[model samples]
Target: MLLATINSSIVLISLPAIFRGIHLDPLEPGNVSYLLWMIMGFLVVSAVLVVLLGRLGDIYGRVRMYNLGFLVFALSSVLLSVDPFDQGAGAMWLIVLRVVQGVGGAMIFANSAAILTDAFPAHQRGMALGINNVAAVAGSFLGLVIGGLVAEWDWRAVFWISVPIAIAGTVWGYRSLHELGSRRTSSMDWWGNLTFAVGLTALLVAITYGIQPYGDHATGWTNPWVVAGLVGGIGLLIAFVLVEQRVEDPMFSMHLFAIRPFAAGNLASLLAATSRGGLQFMLIIWLQGIWLPLHGYDYESTPLWAGIYLLPLTVGFLVAGPVAGRLSDRYGARLFATVGLVLVAGTFIGFLLIPVDFDYWVFALLLLVNGLASGLFAAPNATMIMNSVPADQRGAASGMRGTFMNSGSALSIGLFFSLMVAGLASSLPGSLRSGLTAQGVPSDVAGQVADLPPVGSLFASFLGYNPIQTLLEPTGTLDSLSADHATTLTGKTFFPQLISGPFHDGLVVVFLAAAVMSLIAAAASALGGAKYVHQED
Candidate 1:
């Protein structure tokens, strides 16, 4: 699980180097599709497959499927490290391979919790799952530093590092882990599975693209294709629900929703995961794009240093996760999970109050609070979810829980990104135009530059490129300008200083939305009722 999550996050931190290695400019309008695919493909595939895969684990041996996952993950890591093309083809190769890797990830994620639940008693599930949850949250944080350090040398190393871990885990699992869970022999619900997979995939893929610019519009939410996808996907999902009801052996046991703890816990899980994903992306952009540069970190070093500085967050999670999990075991999950989410909501409010170029200590303090709160919520919430289901349904329930969480993360990249982009759009153009003009850029060139989508600037900053350089180099504006003016325009401080206000405005919008989601998650957690052990059938 640690390896799976670490691999996911490594890709996030190593993206700039990865894109460069593949000879793709992520900021290029035409290439944004590639960028979005690179990020979304793995997530979309995992979200779509985990529920089905979990059912497979229940039908077959959980350990068998898990072993296959390890082997597949190792092979995919090898292929990713040895990507053999450049430019668009290279991007496509990585994307396709990542989807395959996500297949492996789904297998592991879908079954791991169920296996653990089967092996441990109900009273101890929270502690065990809490430790597991720590692997997830902490691994994501650790991957940032690992990817940053290795990507500083070679981007391929990021993928390479996963190989040994996959191999070791595969061997160990095969050697030590056994299938302790009850296996259900049932016919496949091919129709239910197909509709669920295809419908969810279409819905998520549409969400990924809906945030991109469409013609003259700020977002593609109104694009005819997007609208079609939305309606079609929702229609298909409705059909899937209907199909599940009549099936002899439904892949997704919709009856699980009747369990108040299971249903409300999933609702809380989804919203909390969405907030968590959005916070990670938003903070990365804030640090890599603006804050780190302002603090005198070089563009080339920001990715690594951004990860390093965020360690306090990991520290808080590490300190809080296991202890909270153990505490939840004795005290029951409801109070802990609800209070944890409340704390997380309060921290998001803290984010809204902070400045874009915030002091390091203040920023670190906010992150620590967020991390502690999240850790408190994750394990206990996950335990409640896995414990609420019958023994026979545990695998499916774990998969369902994972689906909600992973899907939420996938949706966050789109939903929060759109909110942040829309917020920036209201003020970024004017800021860009005036800032460039003030720096001795030709007004015509400045206007033209400002006219381009703000995503480019946002991405340029994320990739640790000077936004002025990225925007002007293709236009010959840099060549036409005076040396002093060009130097001033391309300096790190210039772009960070210019974008700070607009970025802050965007942060306000994003964090407030996250806070609202967190609060709602708290309400959902509260509705999950007092803890009670599921009686195994």
Candidate 2:
């Protein structure tokens, strides 16, 4: 689980290095889709396939499916590290392999919880799942730190690190683990699987492209294809629900949602996951794009430092998660889960209060609090949902839970980026034009640079690239400027200062929305009612 989840995010911090190694410029207007896919393809595939894969696990054996997943993961990691092409083709190779990797990841995600539930008694399941869940969630954050350290040595090393771990896991799981969970004798729901996969894929793909500029607009939301994807995706998903109702052996057990704890816990999980995912991106951009650079870190080094500095957040999770999980076992998950989300909501409001260039201690404190709150919520919520379902449906329930959380992470990239991009678009062009022209750039050159989509600039910053350098170099404007002007334009502080106001505008909306979501999650968590475990006689 750790290896799978770690690989999911290891690529994020190492992307600049990976792109450089592939000789692909991700910020180029024509190549932006490649960049988006690089980040999202694995997530989208995992989100779409987990339920189907989990259902497969139930039909077959979870250990069998899980063992197969580790083998797939091991092979895909090797393929990812050894790309035989460059430029767009190289990017395509990596993206395709990543989707394969997502398949392996989905398998692990779908069965890990059900396997644990089978292995542990009810009294001990909370602590066991809590520890496991922490590793699952914390691995994403740890990937940032690990990716930065490894990428500094070699870009391919990012994928290479996973090989031995996956191979070891495969062997160990095959030898040591056996199927303890209940299995159903049923055929596959081909229609349910097809509709769900296509529908979800279309929706996520549309969301991925929605942040890019389209036909003079700041975003692709109005694009014909994107519109078609949205409409079609939603239509098919509705069909999926209908089909599930009729199918004797449905891929998704819609009836499981009739259980209050399962339904409400999933709702809270989805909202919390979305907010958590958004927070990760926002913090990375905050550090890599603005805070770290303004504080004198170089663009190329921001990814590493950003990861290191966020250790407090990881620590908070490590400390609180198991404790919360253990306590929830004795008491009820309802109180802990609800209180945790309320705290999570408070922390988001705390973030809104901080300045763009915030004091380190203040930022770290808030991050720590946020992490603690998240840890407090995650295990109990997961335990509550998993426990509420019948033993026979545990695999599907785990998959459904995984689907919501994974899908929420996928959706957050689009939702938050769109909100942030919209905020940047409103005033960024004027700021860029004026800032550049004042620094001795020609008016036409400055206008052209400013007129470029704000998404490019945002991505540049997010990827730890010098935004001014990237924008001005293409126009050959920096060569024309005096050394002083060039130096000021490319220096750490200039772009961060220029963009901070607009960035703050976006931050306000993003963080406020996150806080609201957390509150609603808390409400949902409360609605989950008292702790009640389902027992099948």
Best by lDDT: 2
Q: What is candidate 2's CA lDDT for residue 213?
A: 93
Per-residue lDDT tens digits for candidate 2, residues 1-537, read: 889878977899999999999999998888998899999999999999889888888889888988999999999999999999999999999999999999999999999999999899888888988998899888998999999999999999999989999999999998999999999989889999999999999998999989889989989999999999999999999999999999999998899989999999999999999999999998999899999999999999999999899888889998989999999888879999999999998998998898898899999999899889889999999899988998888888999999999999999999999899988988899999999999999999999999888888889988999999999898888888999999999999999999999999998899899999999999999999898899888
Q: What is the C-alpha lDDT of each candidate?
A: 0.89, 0.92
Tens-digit per-residue lDDT, 393-450, candidate 1: 8778889998999999999998998898898999999999998888788899889999
RMSD score of candidate 1 (Å): 1.0
Candidate number of the best TM-score: 2
- Predicted structure 1, TM vs. truth: 0.98
How many steric overlaps does candidate 1 have? 0
Superposed on all Cα atoms, the candidates' RMSDs to the truth, in angstroms, are 1.0, 0.8
Clashes (N, CA, C under 3 Å) per candidate: 0, 0
How far is 8's C-alpha from truth in model 2 (Å)?
Answer: 1.5
